[model samples]
Structures are given as structure tokens and as C-alpha cells.
Target: MRPRHPRDVLVGYDGSDNARLALQEAIFIAQTSNARMTVVSVVPDVAATINAVWLAGGDPAQLSREMRIEVAATLEEAIEQIPEDVPVTKVLGQGHAGPVLVEQIDRIGCDLVVVGTRGRGAMRALLLGSVTEYLVRHSSVPVVVVPPPERLRDDLA
Candidate 1:
């Protein structure tokens, strides 16, 4: 069950267009409700990262370190976009998006969780899974999922 008024809000951000939209919505909610806000960016686990780098013809060990650095920079940039009036905390999570976010929600004791849909569609999401789909099923608190803009939605379709 969701609280009538949330005291803490957590948003999953990945520096994507849809994530930016979700961040905006989270900012608005936090401002209006006077709730503390947290933004988190999750990187794939070490094994997953290594596999991806190896498959992409990169140095598995060295590239994973570089990838983490890049992701941290991007997460910091996303944090900067939040307005000064809205107090926010930034977190970098390691592991899959859904579980990492759920863990953050638990750690922060957030009352609401916000994330953007990847727009992978039902079939693809079922096959490969998506963070949004996982949260909808697993999150303990209420979740708000922001979809891509209409123009982008057309492209996704």
C-alpha cells in the first residue's frame, strides 16, 4: 500500500531521455509534497560487465573499470540537473537495475519509487525483461513509470 503523502521518493536514473523525464516528474512530486528525493543509477554486475566487454572485443578487466568511471560521471551529471530547491541524494548502484533499485528503496525506506519505461514492448520485455516490468511486480512501495514522449514512442513502436 502507498502512503497518502510520501515522505521519501526514489528515482531510477540512467541518463536516458525517458529517465530524464522520470527525474523531472520526481522533482515535481518532491517539491510539492516536501519529500526527500534520491536518484540512483545502476550498473550491471561485474560478471555481466566483463561478458559484455569481452563480447565487444574489449579488454574485459580494464574496460569494466573504465565503464564504471563513465557511468559515475554520467550519474553525477544527472544529479546536477535537479533544481537547488529540491534536496536530493545521489547513489550509484551495482548489479541489475530492478533489484538494485528495490534494494535502494528498502535502504532508504522510500514511500514511492519512480522510473522510466524502456519501451521494449510486452514481447521483448517478457523475453529479455526490463527494469520497469520488474519493479511493477516486485517493489514494496508504489511505483510511477513515465513513458517516452509521443514522438519517441512512435520510434519505439
Candidate 2:
């Protein structure tokens, strides 16, 4: 049985395979709990950097527009994967994935947040970074970290 307090399950989706697994898990949790599910995608703003580069060379506006379109398409594809019977909502926002996801959790008053972890170790996490780690450290709500699929493990092996 699902907890009563956590009537909402919020998930962060970025079109990654891991994120797709998280979405499936989130749907299961929401179904079992009879809770609402929300899928969120954060589109980082590249305007300033693009503009600066554009001033030097290339078309910033075109690039930015193309990026936005790509993001939207990705989100749409992710949404299509969600189960039709499950009650779900899609949220698209701007900013870094971690902060934006945390903010959305608070804004939506979600009791739990679900994310997929690519299993980055300490050194890699420190150098390359991890969004799951950021959310775990900063989120006000409970966060569930779903590991990559077994197929991924096989591939790695």
C-alpha cells in the first residue's frame, strides 16, 4: 500500500534511458498509491552564451530556437511513454535540472521526488557531476534514486 501523506509522485525526465525507467517506476508507484504523477523536464537557458558566441560568429537565435525545439520534441516523446490509464501531468521549465526539479517539487507540494541515477562514483561525481546527488542534498521532499537497468549492466560488463 502506498503512503497516504505522499499523494503525489514527481519525476525528473531528461529523455535518457534511465529517465524512461524512472518514468515507468513513477507510473507504477502512482498507480499503486492512487496518487497523481508529474513528469518534469528542465530546459537550460543557453541564450546568453549563444548570444556571445553569435556576436563573434554563428547565429545565436537560430541555435537557441533549434535547441528549444529539440527539448520540446524530447519531452513529447517522453510523455508518449507514460501509461494512458495513469493520471499524469507534464511540466517543462527552464534552468539547471537539479534546482529546477527541486523547485517544481516544492511548487507542486509533492511529497516524493523520483530520479534516475547513472551511478557516478565519487571522483566522477566530483569532476563530471551528478543531478541525483544535487537533488538528494537539496530537496525538501523525499527522493528515490533508481539505478540504471540490468541491460545497462550487461552492456558495461
Candidate 3:
């Protein structure tokens, strides 16, 4: 039985092929549940670094501006992956990926958070940071992690 309330599905996209698959899954979930979907791309906060560098005689403002533009473009491309029939809101935020996603879930009252996994093996996942793993462990809301398509995996190898 699907919940009847207006579901808010939050998806994290970083312009990766895996992230694009997640967006497609999120759109399907939103369409089926009559939910509103949000596509979020996190831009890591560099203001403190910029400030420190500025105090130390370096200019970081241009770097920050370029980053913001890149993030915006990434978010826009992610949103374009969703079917036009699905309603979605695009958000560009500044922070580390995990915390930023959790915060946005709470801020938007999202019922579920969807993300993508690169399908790394357990050992590899442990050695390298995994955002999907972090969210699965820490998120208050349920999280759906989509694995990459078989063809995509084949292409990678």
C-alpha cells in the first residue's frame, strides 16, 4: 500500500552516470506516489578556506564563483534527466555531501531520500568514502540506493 500523503522524494545528483540512474528512479517513485521530487547537487563550502587564503594574501573569490557555476550546471543537467511529466524542484546547496543531503531532507520534509551507488565491493567501499553508505546509516528518513546499470558496469571495466 503506497502512502497517500504528499511524498517528498529527495535525490542527490553529481552528474555521474550512476546519479542519473538515481534521478530516473526518483522520478518513477515520485510519479507513482504522487510525490514532489527534489534534485539536489551539493557544492562543498569553501568560504572558510577562501577567507583564510584571502587573509594570507591569496584571492579565492574567482574560484568560488566558478565552483558555484559548475554546481548549477550539474544540477540543471540532472534535472533534465527527469521525465517532463514529473514535478521536480532543483536545489543547489553548499556543504559536504552527506550532511547537506540529510539537512535538505529535514528542511523539505522529504519522505524518502534516493541516491546512487557505484557498486563498489565492500572492501573498496570501506577504503573509499561512500555517500550512500553514510546516508543509509545516518538518515532519519528511508534511503534508496540505485546501482548502476549492467551496461554501464560493463563499460567501466
Candidate 4:
């Protein structure tokens, strides 16, 4: 059997600390394998945001614009950290994180998918934030789930 070497890598990033760690690991993998890296951030349907903005006495359009700007800024910051030599692309996805990432994995012809887990607890995991779980169960290629660093886990505990 031959060891797998990815030619294209896709990472799920949401600007969280854990996501940053995942991105770092993805970068390392892409660098080692000479793969193109795609960083994706999924923004779910804006209906909830619109409702919240309306309830908060703000213009929904204005809030939506601000959110887009914030998302762009966050992605830009992440992109800046990537080295100059690595071929990279950024994608802004709509809808749920798990489904969107899977779609991107196929669309980008990626052989590996990287995502971060909060490492809150197995019990809690059953209830919320199942992006990593979903990918592990459904990804056709390979999924790498990066948990928070040991120090961060200790601090959270």
C-alpha cells in the first residue's frame, strides 16, 4: 500500500481559536505535500441575523453589510498568516458548515479536509457543534479533526 499524499487541501475555518489551530496544521500539511490550500468559512442563512437585527432596532441591511465586512476582514487576517509560497484560495460559503464544507471538498477536488473541534466534551458534542463529527462520518476522501492544543484544553478544563 502506498502512503497518501494530498494534492489539494481544504480547511474549515471560522476565525475561532481552534479554527486557527486547524488552519495552521492545514498549512503545514499543504506545505509538506506541495498542495493547494483552500480556506473556507461558512455563513449560515441570514434569516436569523435579520431577525436579531430587527429586534435590536437596527437596519437589517446595514447589519448584513457589516457582517459581510467582518467576515472578509477575518478571512483576510487568516490569509495574511499563510506563507507567500503556498498556493491558496479563500471561499465564503452559505448554509450550514458541514454541508458547505463537503460541497467545497468535492468542488475544489481536495483529497483531504481539515477541521477543528472545540474539545468541550464527548457528552456535549452529541448536542452541538457537530461540524467535525459530520465530516468524519461523511467525507469521501479523508478528514482530519484538530482539537485544541493541550494548554488550551487544560485552561478550559
Candidate 5:
């Protein structure tokens, strides 16, 4: 049985192909139910060094600026894909992906959180702990994980 009536819905859109698929589902539910929709993009906190070398020659500010600009552009592209009839607020959450998603859901009082995943095997998911798996277990609110398009097609077949 599917759940009915989502009040405030949040979608974690990282501009990935799977995320775009998730956004489509989110838009449908939000539009049909007239629920408030928020599209969230989570960016990892800036790290200047990978090993001994600095990302931008030890310039954290420059690295931060560049990442933000790229992320913003991706966010805008995602926004453009959204229908104007369905209102969606864009939000940029900073931190690790999983925690940022959980935090935004709580801060925005979102009852439903939609996310996208590659839908890897159980062993791989347990070993790597993908964000979808993390959110599914960690989030106090409801989490709906939308798998990649091919996975959905295969499931239908």
C-alpha cells in the first residue's frame, strides 16, 4: 500500500541522473497533493588537501569558490527541468551528504524525503554504506529511495 498525503516534501537532488529521476517523482507527488516542495543539493565541506598537495595550491577559499559556482550551475540546470506550475524552492546544504539530508528534513519540518540511489547489491551497500542506505536507516522521517531508470525498467519486466 502506498502512503497518501505528503504535507511538506523534500527531495535530495545532487544533479545525478538518478537524482533527476527522483525529482520527477517528487514533482508528481507534490503537484498532485499540493504539498510544499523543496529541492535540496548537498555539497561536501571543502577540503584543501587530498594527501600532501593542496587542491588549489593551498588556497581553500579559491577551491571553495570554484566548487560553489559549479554546484550552483548544476542546481540551476536542475531547477530549469522543474515545471513552473509545481513550485519548488532550491536549497544548498553543506556537509556530508547523509547528515546534510537528514538535517535539512528536520530543519524544514519535512515529512517525506525522496532520494535517488544506484541500488547496489546488499553486500556492496553494506560495505560502502551509500547515502540512500544511510538515509533509509538513519532518517527519523520517511525516506523514499528512487532507483535508477534501468532498475525500474528491469523491475517492471
Candidate 6:
């Protein structure tokens, strides 16, 4: 069976292995389907009071700048993997992960969205919630959830 082609595809990237796989899949789909791709990374915003409390001695401005730099690097790595023939755009967003992704989906008018899920980290979940789950439930467009690589899967026999 053939999968439907997406006109404009949006992928959420975080520089994780799962995200790398998702980017690879999205690129292949974009290439075969003659679709354009957009890659987005989120730089979560911590409130000033929270930063002062949790960050302690860390400089807020420096931390924000570093986050932007990391986001740019992630985009650059994804861009390098993409074939030259495929049309692609990159965006670095600020704020919470789920809402930012949802906002980008609407703002970009993408027909499809791709995201990657990570291992269950209780601390991470308690802090950031689940972006993948939120997108699967709330996104107006279709979504593809890419799991960890085969080598990383412990269930395979």
C-alpha cells in the first residue's frame, strides 16, 4: 500500500537520535512525495524568577544565547542531511515545546507533522509534559511519531 503524499511537511527536531530518525524519514517522504519540508526546534522559556531561583549563578542572557546557538546547530545538522533538491525551511521557537510546535503547524499551513519520542524519563515528563502525545491529540493536521532506532530497541527478538 502506498502512503498519501503531503504537500508541506513540518518536523519537530531536538537533536536526539529519535529526532534524527524522524528527520531522515521526513526527508525521504518529502523527496518521494515532491513535498517541501520545514524543521523546527524549541528553546524552552524559563521565567525570570524561575531562572533566578533554579539557575542560581547562571546568567539568564547567556543561557538564552546558548540555547539559540544550540537550536541553530541542530537545524544546520538536519539541513546538511537533506538533499539539495528538496525545499526546506528552518525555524527556532521559544516557550513550551508542545504549544510552540502546535503554533508552528498552524502558522506554516503544513499538511503533515513529524515528531520523535524518547525514553520514559519521569523527571522530564513531570517538567515538560509530552509533546508527542499532545501533537497526536491536538494537531489539526496528520502526525507521524518516529520511535527510537532499531539498535536502541530492547524488545526485538
TM-score versus the correct structure, for each prediction: 0.85, 0.83, 0.80, 0.88, 0.81, 0.84
Q: What is the lDDT of residue 3 in candidate 3?
A: 45
Weakest ten-residue segment in model 3 by summed lDDT: 120-129
RMSD values for the candidates in order, in angstroms, are: 3.1, 3.2, 3.6, 2.2, 3.6, 3.9
In candidate 5, how many Å is residue 99 off? 0.8
Enumerate clash totals for all models, in the order shown: 0, 0, 0, 0, 0, 0
Which residue runs of candidate 3 sit more than 4 Å off their true CA positions?
Answer: 1-6, 47-58, 125-129, 151-157
Off by over 4 Å in 6: 1-4, 48-55, 121-129, 155-157
Model 6 Cα shift for residue 105 (angstroms): 1.1
TM-score of 1: 0.85
Error of 3 at 139 (Å): 1.0
Error of 4 at 53 (Å): 2.2
Clash number for model 6? Answer: 0
Worst 10 residues of 6 by lDDT: 120-129
lDDT of 6: 0.82
lDDT of each: 0.83, 0.80, 0.83, 0.84, 0.77, 0.82
Across 1-157, the per-residue lDDT of candidate 2 in tens digits comes to 9645458899988888889888888888888878888888877878688978788998887787777778888888878977787777789888788888888888988889888867444445432227888988999988888877776544333
The segments of candidate 2 whose C-alpha lies over 4 angstroms from its true place after superposition are: 1-5, 47-56, 120-129, 154-157
Model 3: per-residue Cα lDDT over 39-130, one tens digit each? 89988889798999899987798778888899999999987777777778888988888988888888888889888877455456433236
Q: Pick the candidate with the highest TM-score.
A: 4
For residue 122, what is the lDDT in candidate 1? 45
**lDDT score at residue 98, model 3, on the 0-100 scale:** 90
> At residue 34, what lDDT does model 5 achieve?
88
Candidate 1 residue spans exceeding 4 A from truth: 1-3, 46-58, 120-129, 155-157
In model 5, which runs have C-alpha deviations exceeding 4 angstroms? Answer: 1-3, 48-58, 119-129, 151-157
**Ranking of candidates on TM-score, top first:** 4, 1, 6, 2, 5, 3
Per-residue alpha-carbon lDDT of candidate 5 for residues 67-131, written as tens digits (9 for 90 to 100): 77887787787788778877778888777888888888888888898887764454554332278
The model with the greater TM-score, 1 or 4, is 4
Show pairs that collide, candidate 4: none
Q: What local lDDT does model 1 show for residue 86?
A: 78
